[model samples]
Structure formats: C-alpha cells, structure tokens
Target: MQKQTGFASILLILLIGLALTTLVIGMVTSVRSLQDSSLTTHAQTQAQIKSAIGYQALTGLLKPLTATQIAQINNGVIKDNGSPAATIATYKVVTTTEGCPASTGGKNYFCYDITAKSGGASSVVRAIYTDITTGGGSFNGSIFAGGLQIGHTRNLQGDQTIQVGAAPGGENGVVKGNGSSTFYDDQAQFTLATGITVQEYTPTKFMTAEELRASANYIFYANGKCAKNNLYGASIYNTETEPVTCSSISGITVSGSGASKKWTIDAASSAIPVGVLWFEGEVDINLNSSRDLVNTIIATGDMKVITTNQSGAGKAYAPYHYYLEASTNAATKKTRICGSSSTGIPTQYCDTAGTLKALDTELAKIANILFLSNKNITFDVKSNSPMSLYGNIIGSGGAGGTGASSGKFTGNGTIDIKGNLSFTGEGLTVTNGTVNVKLNRGDSSGNVTPSKKVMTLSGLRYM
Candidate 1:
C-alpha cells in the first residue's frame, strides 16, 4: 500500500515538466512571428515613401527619363534623404519585356521591386507601375497619370515671347511661337484683330470726233480733207484750180548711161520750160548715189512713181528752197505752185517775187509724196515717256534688207532719244522733213518753258 502512493507522485511530476516545456516553445514562436510582421511592415512603408519621392523627382525632369536612367535606381545608383545609400526598394524603367500598365501601348514605364528581409528569410513585393493622368500619384520619380506617361498643356500668345536656348542643343537657333497662344497635337490656329478689303475705279467715255475737232487748238488734215471733220466741225482746207495748155516746150532731154541714168531738165538758162517723158518700164528716181541717197541726188527723170532699189534708201526734198525761188517770176503763178498752172494764184503762193514758176509746184509735190510714204515705214523709236514727231523721220535701208551697203548703213544710223521731248510750242517749227523735238525745264513752282531747254544729240556721225 505505501509503494502504490509513491508511484502516483512520480507520474504527476513528469506531466508538469512536459507541460512547461510546451509553453516555452509556444512563447518563443509567438515572439519570432511578431518580429517578422514588424520587419515586413517597416520595409513596405519605406519602399512606398522612397518610391513616392523618387517619382516626384523624376517628374520634375519634365522630359521622359530613359531606361538607362531608371536602371540606375534599380542598380542602387541613388541617394537617401541625407546620404548615398541603398534602400529596400529597387526601381527601373522598361520600354519592353514587361507587361506593366505604364509599358502599355508599346510605351515605357517606371517599375519598382520591393523586398523585405528578416533573419534568413525575405518577402518580395513586385509589380508597381504608373501611367500618365491629369491627377494621379507618380512612382519612382516617373511621370504618372492613368497608368501612362503624362504630357503638359501649352498656351502660346502673340504678345508673349519664348526662350528656346534654355534647352540643350538649342543654344544658337531659337524658334518662337508668338502668334498662337495654345498648341495641341502639334497643331496651332490663331486669330487676328482685323481683316482686309479691296476696291477699284472705272472711267467715263470721251468726246466725239467732230466735237474734239471744233474745240482742239490744232487741226489735222490728210488727203486734202480733215479726217475728224465728222467728229469736230472743222472744214477741210481746199483750193480750186484749172488745167493749163502748153504752147511750146524746150530744154528737156531723156538720157541713160552704163551704171548711171538721167533725164535732165534745165530752166535756169531759159525763161521756163515744161516737158514730160513717158517711160515704158518701172522707173527709179535715184538720189545722188546708191549708198548716200539721204543727202544726194543721182538723177531726175519722169519717174512719177519712185521706187527704192536698196533696202534703206531715202528720198529727202525741201519745199522751202523751191518756194523761195518761184516768187520772183511774174508769169509763174504763186497759187499755182503745186496746182494746175491754169488756176489763178493765191497771193501767199508766191513769196516776194511775182513769178509763178512751175519748179516750186513740182518740188512741193515731190516733198509731199516722199514725206507721206515714210509715215508708213516701221522703225525703232522709243522715248522715256510719250513723244510726238511732227515731221517725217526717214531711215535708210534697202528694198527688203536692213542696211544700204552689204552689211553697212549709209551713215551712223542709230537713233537714241532720252529725256523729255515735246512736239509743239511757240518756237516749235516743223517743216515737211524737219526732225522736231521739244525740251523744257520746270521752275520751282512747277511751271515749264519748252523753248529754253535744249536736247543734246550725241554719237551721231554721218558715215
């Protein structure tokens, strides 16, 4: 009976020892678990704080950060708030090889890989990224909103200017946007304060021909009649004449020679002789020489119809010489100068001489015919402004060629005109063959005196 009681006591002591050992084991496991939880919490908070700060710093850079730049953070290329140190959080930017939302649409984004360490164990928190948005937190110093890279808005205006060289590689050349205030998707449109308009003018018709003629200062007559008579109430200057009957004729000869020809008529020795020659073929009234037709006469014939054998040959006749000589003869009617000799003379037809010689009539007719023909010839005549030539301006050239000789003109043939040239003034005398030009100077009050100014001619050498 005493031995059984001692056995029970030994069993009780063994149970108590087993229970104490289990309690110590449980306490140790609880302490270790709490420490692990604290370590994880601290690591996670540090990583989040570091990532937030890093993202803000990155966004401050404005321009997108390259992958290599973000890689520096992952590779521990970073600094703490006060020192260069490696934190629990590692970050990088990837343009590819990651399915991150920041890398969506084939773009790049910032990525952070966080790990918590305690004793010999580690916990990893991965897959944090950002995208651009209007208002969203950044990650690892990277721009983020709506899980994509963010872009800023720009407003440009005309009154404002910009500095471009502030950016890199843009030191010398700067393009400014001053016209438009805002740009979107690389497009810009602007407005202005004012616009533009246009206007034109039309003129009224001028007076009729007869009206102008009646009111004009000068009269123009052609072919013994005024062309503008129907427009202006101007009468044609016409004279009546009768034909004459010749009783006898003398001092007349028709002659031609090899390389030369002439039908000579001389009335200087005789009182007055009038005769006519009938030509069987077309005739040429040759001037002095074929090469010098403008200044000389080779022969005179009954060739009433004058033909030019050379391209630039000219016929020049002066009625003044003939008119001055015919006035002396009483039998030569002055009014019958160019009209039929049977007509009575107009007093002005004769100069001081009462003689009405037929020579003046013939010569006047020749001058009129030659001068009128030259009016149809075309030549290079230019002026600084508009100018009028009162008389005939004859240029010498062969029948169809442009010069008198093989390749030469009769004389220095160029006509160069410069400055103001007028046609009519008080002293402006224009005869049948006169080269009339007007020169004038304006006074301080803008008044002009045409006769006082002179036109200078240069480079005109008679060849």
Candidate 2:
C-alpha cells in the first residue's frame, strides 16, 4: 500500500512538471509575437514619415525641372541618393493626357507613385503636381534705349523718363526732349540710369535667333530660304492648322533686300497662330491676338511696330515685331498671353518650368513673351494717331542695322511710346509729333496683374 502511494505521488509530480513546461513555452511564444508587432509598427511609422518628406520635396524640385528629367530619376538613369540605403524613396511616374480634373487635354498634370521603406516596412503615396507663375523676372523700366529723342509729351501719363545706354562709339548719346530736342550727339537731359546695361535688352539674352527659328510654327526667310509666310513643314506645337491671310497674298510681304529688306506681316483672322513668327529680315509687324497660347515674334533684322496705317486708318495696330504676349494696341482685345481675360491669376497657362524652353515655345512663352530684337526698333505712328501699345519692346542696334547709322536714330517719326523701350540705338529723331510716352507699366502678358507660371500650385500639400 505504501509503495502504491509513492508511485501515485511520483506520477502527480511528473504531470505538474509537464504542465509548467508547456505554459512557459506558450508565454515565450506570446512575448516574441508582441515584440514582432512592435517592430513592425515602428517600421511602418518611419516609412510614412519618409513618404511625407518626399511629397513635400516636390514643391522645391518641381519647377526648373522637366518631365524628362523626372523620368530619368525614376528609371534609374539618375543616381539614387540617401544617407542609408533603406531611407531613400523610390518612385514611378505616370503621365496622362486626362489625368487631373484641370487637365482638359494634353499632358497637363503628372503623378508620382512613390514608395519609401524602413526595415521591412514600405509605404506608398500618389501625388499630382501642377504649378503657377505668380512671380519670376520683372521689367526694369518702361523704356530702355541706347539713345532717347523726345520733342514733346504725347500721352500725359506714359513713361516720362527713358533709360539710355551708350552707343557703340562711347558717345554719351542724346535725349532731344528736355533740352534742344536735337538728334545730334549731345548730353542726356534725363536722369542717366547707365548702371542699367544694354545687354539685358537683347531678346537673344532670353533666346537666340537660331533657337527661335527652329521653334517657329511659321517662318519667312527674307534671306529667301523658304517660301515667304506659312512654313511648309509639320509644326512643333501643331499650330499650322490654318494660314493667317484669306487672300492669295501670303501673311508676309517683302519689298527690299539685304539689311533694308522690308517684311510686312498681316494678322491671323481665322485662328490665333501659335509659336513664334520668326522673320529673317527687318519687318513692320502687325501684332494683336485673342488667344494667349502662342504669340511671339522674333526678327534677325530691324523691327518697326506699325501702330496705324501710314494713311489714316481708324483701327489700332499692335506691331510688326515679336508678339510675346496677347497684349494688343486695341483695348478691346485684352486676353493676356498667359491667362484669361481678367480672370483670377493665370492657371491654365501655368507651365512646366525648365531651361529647355529656348526651343520649346509650347512651354517657353507660357510665362512671358520676351518680345525682343537684336537690332534697332521703331514705334511708328503719328502723334495724333489713335493708338496705344500695351506691351514692352527691346532690341539691339540703332535705327541703322549695326552700319554707318548704327550709332544714331535717323528714323522719321516721334520717339513716342505708350509702354517701355530699351535699345542700344543712337537716339530718336522725333521732329514732328509730341512725345506721348507715358510710364504706363501695364501688367505683363495682358493680365490685369502679372500671372507667371507654371506658378506655384496652391494644392501642392503633404499627404
């Protein structure tokens, strides 16, 4: 009986020992599971934080960057960078013609499918990007001239003071208004802002003539390269859907040869022509357009802005030179170059910013139409001509195309301008009309206020 009792006790002890061992094993397994859960939670939080960082980084890096460059970064064409390998963000880019709600057509918006990691955890976010150009470069003054000639004030409020630069021969230049109003080389009567350089006024400073020549939706070679007016090749911006003139006469009318070649261009009545109107020879440009999409003109020769018919024509004329913005001489046509007519800050025309625009007018002129010339310019109109030029003009040499008259303005008209002028020409020869130049620094690109873009997007926020 005693032996049986001893055996039962031993059996009970063995059972208890087995139970304790199982409980300990179960508890250890539970603890390990909890530890893993905590580790995963930490990793996931880190990944989310990293993803947010990438989202915000886009604001600074979006502009001055093109979709091509972004793709390069995504396709590993660009080197990956990060302190720790796991901390870097990885992304894929997907472009769509109709992706964002604002995108009516075209690749208007881009999205980033981003993946960021921490330990074994990964996070993803999809971000759409758009920009607005509220601020960028600004106009230095109403008029910038290599020389100034003023007989009398035509417009009461127009730019009273003209910015002057030295002509080629170290001539102090001349302003004919305040003093004798003479065209001969004389002292400047206005405050000489000589610190303002003439190099800044060159349209080529913004883009070269060759670069513009390549981007033109339509081109005329006074050099007689191709047929005058309406280029024959496929347009870069798909803008050559129609011609400017309805009659047999092409848009460009040429009369002379060499530097004196006279090129006159008519306006597009059917559709607002897109891309640059690049002319190889000097021209009398008629500038005015409703749509702000593509309206810029560039000339290799001299420029003359025809404000009205030399005969008494009642209608207003813009210019024969470059049309950087949608600003028209006729106030009735106020569609800005980068925005709608007096709408909120320009959004639709806000652009994909990049240095690649010298050849891409589709995006280059979306902000400002660098309406400039490498040669001299003439704002041609009678003093009483019912006209007003609401845009800015810049050019190179004098009334002479870098020749004997290169150092002076011998053009037969008043130096009257409604906007600003910056040139390296000798001076104006305003012998007949009143100086109507009022410092009317109107909003750039035709907007009531400047709307540059593609501007900073108000919707760009961290998710």
> Largest TM-score belongs to which candidate?
2
Taking the tens digit of each residue's C-alpha lDDT, what string does model 2 give over 1-463? 6657688789999999999999999999999999999999999998887777766665456666754554455421112365544335665664564243354432345566666788999887677765423321344453334444345433223323444544334345543344352433422322332211222223212334554454444556655544223232333133323433322335556787766777776543324333345677777765333212234566777776554434332232222112332345423233222223222222223222211123132334322333455566555554334334434455655553234222222223233333444454444323234434334444443221122345234333333
TM for candidate 2 is 0.44
Q: Which ten residues in a row have the lowest lDDT in candidate 2?
A: 350-359
Q: What is the lDDT of candidate 1?
A: 0.25
Question: Any runs in candidate 1 off by more than 4 Å, and if so which?
Answer: 1-4, 62-76, 81-89, 100-463
Task: Give candidate 2 misplaced runs (Cα > 4 Å).
Answer: 1-136, 143-145, 152-162, 167-208, 223-249, 256-261, 267-275, 286-295, 307-362, 366-371, 399-418, 425-435, 444-463
Candidate 1, 320-392: lDDT as tens digits: 2223322345333232232334322222222223343332221121221111110112221122211211112
lDDT of every predicted structure (CA atoms) = 0.25, 0.45
* Predictions: Cα RMSD each: 43.1, 14.6
